[model samples]
Target: MAKKDKADKKGGKKDKAARKKDAEREVVNGVFAPLVTQTARSLRTLLSRDLADCGLYAGQDGVIQALAGEDGLTPGALAQKLGVKAPTMTRTIGRMEAQGFVERRADTLDHRLTKVFLTDGGRASLERIAAAAEACEREALHGLSGKEVKTLLRLLLTVEENLQSAIGKR
Candidate 1:
């Protein structure tokens, strides 16, 4: 009976240690996800302010840059390139068209299809957009060394890939 009581005590200690480790892991995971999310939100807010000076929004810059690279792309293609849904792309295009930044045209080859083209205003804003993005990046990386920046980028890419893989599995 004495030996059995000692064994139970040892097992309880192991269980307590395991629970402590699990709680630590949970705390780390909880902090990590919120930190990443808050960082992203803060960066977007900063970038949005900079972009506002250039008469653009946070997301509109991506569309402008994409259209600058490929002059005419369908809304569906743009959605795929930007990793957004088709409806969202369509609404963005509509807003941009209203703002005179982009215009939709019937595809020359396929009349049934519509392609989005950057307007003269959009073309002219490209330089300011680039400058805004650069400023945002500089502010974000203000205190980080090049090595630190590279490591951060690598780690973020790994995290993104892991999340994407999990999403794909789902």
Candidate 2:
């Protein structure tokens, strides 16, 4: 009976050790999500400060950049491209219009469709916006080597694609 009791004690210890190891492994594996979230928050804060100097907000930069790529996009198209809702895009466009950065006009051929175009002031801000984004990226990648930066970008893209696929599944 004593021998049986000793065997049970040894088995219990092994079980506890195995459980501890699994917990540690899970903690290590779980760090990816939090780290990515924290990094995104930090990057947004940095970019926001830089963007503020250009007389723009964090999200406003994306709108400007998208317009620069292809001018005269509809608010709905902008919303879809920016991954925002229509109302949010409308408010953003209204604020930009008020700021003299963008203007809305009816499409010539299809007057019913409203198109957003960059105003003269918005076109002038392009350089400053580019500089601000460059500065933000520079600060974010200060220590990393070129290769490391490329690898990080690749991994992030892969992760993003995986997440997008998962979202589509749901």
Each candidate's TM vs. the true structure?
0.82, 0.83
- Please list the C-alpha lDDT of all candidates, in the order they appear: 0.94, 0.93
Name the lDDT of candidate 2: 0.93
For residues 1-170, could you state the per-residue lDDT of candidate 1 as single tens digits? 99999999999999999999999998897699899999999988998998898778779999999999998999999999999999999999999999999999999999999999999999999999888878889999999999999999999999999999999999
Could you tell me which residue pairs clash in candidate 1?
none
Q: Ten-residue segment with the worst summed lDDT in candidate 2? A: 49-58
List candidate 1 stretches off by more than 4 Å.
1-26
For TM-score, the strongest prediction is: 2
Q: List the residue pairs that clash in candidate 2.
A: none
RMSDs, each prediction?
4.9, 5.1
**What clash count does candidate 2 reach?**
0
lDDT, candidate 2, 84-147, per-residue tens? 9999999999999999999999999999999999998998888988888788899999999999
